[model samples]
Target: MTHVVTESCINCKHTDCVEVCPVDAFHEGPNFLVIDPDVCIDCIACVAECPVAAIYVDSDVPASQRQFLALNAELARDWPVIVRKREPLPDAAHWADVTGKIDHLQHP
Candidate 1:
């Protein structure tokens, strides 16, 4: 099963997970990241790399965040692939522990 990047990642935009992704399945957005289900190999390599614990196996995604499964797939189609790790957004530390920040996700 593919992994899903959840709402906890929306504003934080941490790239640690992207660096561990062997398949380069990660897609970068203006302020978030998504895993392309089509390209993911279920390696689980990126899960632990997420500082916010935002990455989860498709089956392990919590019920409250299940929407991320579809969101990841949808966004991955258009967002550019991100294969290298980069610093998180300047306000990442502030947003990392914030709950329910999905509305803050930037599509551009």
Candidate 2:
């Protein structure tokens, strides 16, 4: 199973999890991050490092944010490897831009 980056991550865009992921499975999102299910290895290194506790195994994803499970897989197919992820402050000031954008970025 894959890990899901939940809505909690929307404003809590800390990138430390990305820093520890070994497979380069993490991808950039407008206000958060997405994990590549195919490459994740279910290592869960990202989950423990997430300060806000935004990451979860797919089966444990909260009902409201289930869409992210699909979003991750869809985005993974095309997301580039992140060579140097950095810690980021909460994007509370700019989260208005994240809504509905994932629907437009699909996997080929």
Candidate 3:
């Protein structure tokens, strides 16, 4: 029942959600953030903070993006929860400068 990071988040990577996650379920991915489902506790804490509206509850994910739920949980199994997202990764600026990059980068 963990929350999922939808494709909308791919390049829209504003990290506001990371700051609010109680369990630090999120970690930086190459071009996005990944949620560690095992640590997520299904808290739904990160969803509302996302400026791009890219977070989703598993059942609420758009049908086109349903696979992200599995992807989120799978990635979280082996990696540890971040516990603190004190800073955005070095790549944040690139994401900031680009407009509509998220529309182009969504995972299939």
Candidate 4:
């Protein structure tokens, strides 16, 4: 199973996980990051790096956030690959623990 970047990642866009991904499976969006399922190695390296705890194995994604699996897949196809860690959004700390931010996700 692949890891999915869930709603908690929206607007926060922490890239710590990106740096740990062995396959460079992460894709960058305007305010989010998604893992390309086809490229993820199921290594689980990104999960612990996420300060917001937003990365989950596809099988472990909460039912409420299940849609993220498809969302990650769909967006990864178009977003540019992100291989380096970058500063998170300026408001990341403010948004990190906030719940239900799906509508705030920014696509590019």
Encode model 2's per-residue lDDT on 1-108: one tens digit a residue.
888876666755677788788887888765567888888888888898877677999999988778889877876666675646665745544643455444443344
Q: Could you give candidate 4's per-residue lDDT for residues 1-108 as a string of tens digits? A: 899999999999999999889999999999999999999999999999999999999999999999999999999999999999999999999999899898898775
Please say which candidate is ahead in lDDT: 3 or 4: 4
Predictions ranked by lDDT, top down?
Answer: 4, 1, 2, 3
Error of 4 at 82 (Å): 0.2
Candidate 4, which segments miss by more than 4 Å at Cα? none
Number of clashing residue pairs, candidate 3 = 0
**lDDT by residue (tens digit), candidate 1, 41-108:** 99999988999999999999999999999999999999999999898999999998999898898884
What is the C-alpha local distance difference test score of each model? 0.93, 0.73, 0.70, 0.95
lDDT (tens digit, per residue) of candidate 3 on 9-108: 6665677888788777886655567787667788788888876677888788988777778777765665445545445546655655554454464333
Error of 1 at 97 (Å): 0.7
Please report how far candidate 1 places residue 87 from its true position, in Å. Answer: 0.8
Report the error of model 1 at residue 105, Å.
0.8
Give per-residue lDDT, candidate 3, residue 19. Answer: 79
Model 4 worst lDDT window (10 residues): 99-108
For candidate 1, give the lDDT: 0.93
Segments in model 2 whose C-alpha atoms lie over 4 Å from true places = 90-108
